[model samples]
Target chain A: MSKVLVADFGTGNLHSVMTAIQVVSSGSEVEASRSARKIRMADRLILPGQGAIGTWMSELQDDNVRQAVNEAVRTKPVLGICLGLQALYEHSEEDGGVEGLKVLAGRVERFSDGLNDCGHRIKIPHMGWSKVHQTCQHPLWSGIPQDTRFYFVHSYFARSDRDSEVAAVADYGLEFTCAAARENLFAVQFHPEKSRRQGLRLLTNFLNWNGEV
Target chain B: MPLAKRIIPCLDVDEGRVVKGVKFVNIRDAGDPVEVARMYDRQGADELAFLDITASSSNRETILHIVEAVANQVFIPLTVGGGVRTVDNIRSLLNVGADKISINTSAVERPEFIEEAAGRFGSQCIVVAVDARRVPDTNPPAWEVYTHGGRKPRGLDAVEWAKRMCDVGAGEILLTSMDRDGTKIGFDLELTRAVSSAVPVPVIASGGVGELSHLADGIEFGWADAVLAASIFHFGEYTIAQAKEHMKGRGIEVCEIIDEFE
Candidate 1:
């Protein structure tokens, strides 16, 4: 059984993700911690976050979490969800534009105003579920069909420097990257824990994944 | 596909058990909240809302426990409503796994509470529940905010109130048409369209969903991003998958996942 450490950088929905990880992995030990020791010792790491980028960044930078997360990103298998995915980028348009974790090459941009789909005004935050299309093959995409809708609640999205890094994309008036992947690092802009069976399937895949692209 | 319109099954909890009060006059025992939530989740329910209508505030801890149980098992966004007054209440619900907190009476009483809650908890988690009743004898028909289950009027315009709620940091508005509520007819399309058009946030049309056609009308004609119903879903009149199927037949985008897990 894998020991999964969900890096809780003082964010919301921490328990939701923790419960999901445990439900998917029968014997896997899932924990929420800010301890660098537990993070480094865990077999897998899941980064879950929400709310503003300013606050999320500040909390992550405290208690040696920033340093610990960086180390885990380089060596251990790590997964990011929602705000966790945005933090991977170099910067974000949220909170009056704040700097991100810089783990990947990208910038987070807010949805442009007055976007219409067939004359219907698209709301901000892009709340609710949307279909995610797999653009590349990865272990995380296993068992999940292409265009499977996942629960997403966000205003800003990631714009990667390279298209090859995008594992999946979802549309909300405009197509945007929903999942990004690299060696030992995979992140999604949707809440898999809040997503149903397919979401649980994705978490199961991640638990069984060895972080090999 | 764009973001699929959400279909939420609202369950009213009273005294730690699930019950549905049709128009707040006839209360019927539905089932356990956790079990019902699981049934909906397996049936591809987009989301679930637990309205704690437990009159006695002493049993407040009951809904929290129920939400915690469901959140631990069910893998979908859960919204808890009915009697959310303070930031502490919002924090407690969110901490117990409520993806969103729906505010109705408190939001109408103190608009500043929405601002404070949204500021402290982020706008994405705050959902202001607006109960709108159409004023009688109006040329084009205007609606006003009514609290206490449409028994009292807050003297505020429904459309303008929705706009104000969004302006004060509410991420979404759960607009219920008091005039159409419990009527088998349909949603107040005029009221829904007016409010949805006025606000930049997503609006959930609620309070009068009788059949599958009403669900479609709420999304297609009313311009609501989501449709919430209780009676049709709680009493076994319709399942979520069936509702999605009916909505999809009408060209509305709805989400359904095929489980590939062994």
Candidate 2:
């Protein structure tokens, strides 16, 4: 059984993440904790966050979760979701620019005002499910087909500096990076927990994955 | 493509079971809230809203338990409403895995409550539910906001209240037409259009959804970002897949339904 630690940054839906992980990955022990030692000891780590970047940053610092996450990601597979994915970037334009964890070389950007293919004005939050186009092959993508829809709810999206790190892309008004992957880290701007069957498949893959590229 | 229009199935819960009725009368038991919610999730519902119609304090614990149970198995966006009078109530629901909280009566009583809740939690998590009814005697036949489950009408105009709620920080407006509710004729397109145009946030055109085409009309004509229904879905008149297929055929963008699990 895998020991998975869902790092609680005090912002997002920590319980839901833990619930999804436990429900999808049976036999694996999943716990949501703010403890640095527990996070370091886990086989896999999940950094789940939501809400504003400014408050998230402060909470991470106050709880010292930023350092714990940075340490855990180096030696183990780490996955970030929603604001957690954005937090892995260098900085974000949210709340007048807040510094992120800088685990990945990217910046979070807001969608510009534009009309979609339907000529309708795009909503800001980009709320609802959308298809994720796989840009490259990885263990996490196993058993999941290309262009599978995942649930997304955010105003800002991550733009990785290195195109090689982008694992998948999705279109709103324009195409943007939705999932990023590095040596031992994989982060998605969408919520896999809320993506139904495909989401559960991805979580199951994560549970079975080792810390590898 | 733009974000797909959402089709949400609302479950009016009382003391932990799912119930449905016409205009809050002639209520009938549907089933266990969690089981019904799981069925809808499997049927590919875009979202789910659970309103505790029995807002009495005695049933509050049961509602929270139901929310937790549904949230565990549903794996989709869940919005919980009824008796959300304070930030603490919103927090409790969110803690139990509710993605959003809808406020109706409290929002009308203290308009600033919308601003406060939206400010504390992000606006995306705050939904202002407006239950409105048409008043033909007015010069423009304005719709007035109703409280206590459409039993009491307030002086505030529906469109104006929707605009104010958006300005203050309501991420979405759940506009329900009391006149058209449960009648199965269709949504009040005029009222939906008025509010949709008045606010920049996404508007969920709710109530009076009987036929499948009404769902399409709510998007094509009413300019609603989403359409919500209870009776049709609860009674199994049409599956969510059928509704989405019909809407897609009508040129409305909807999330493709994937029924298989690998």
Model 2: per-residue Cα lDDT over B1-262, one tens digit each: 7467899989999877777642321234346887788778877899999999998888888888998998888889899999889888888888999988999999999999999987777887889999999998877668999999999989998999998998898888999999999899999998998887777677999989989999999998888899999998877778888999999999887888665672
On lDDT, the candidate that comes out on top is 1
**Could you say which candidate leads in DockQ?**
1
Off by over 4 Å in 1: B21-29, B259-262
Q: What is the lDDT of residue B131 in candidate 1?
A: 93
State residue B186's C-alpha deviation in candidate 1, in Å: 0.4
Worst 10 residues of 2 chain A by lDDT: A114-123
Worst 10 residues of 1 chain B by lDDT: B21-30
Q: Residue by residue across B1-262, what tens digits does model 1's lDDT show?
A: 3689999989888888787632321233236777788777777888898888863579879989999999988889998998889999988888888889999899988999999998887888999999999899987889999987678999999988898899999999999998898896999999999998889898999988889999999988999999999898777778888999999999998886564532
At residue B174, give the lDDT of candidate 1: 93
Which stretches in model 2 have alpha-carbon errors above 4 Å? A62-64, A117-119, B21-29, B137-141
C-alpha lDDT (0 to 100) for residue A140 of candidate 2: 96
Tell me how candidate 2 scores on lDDT. Answer: 0.86
Clashes of each: 0, 0
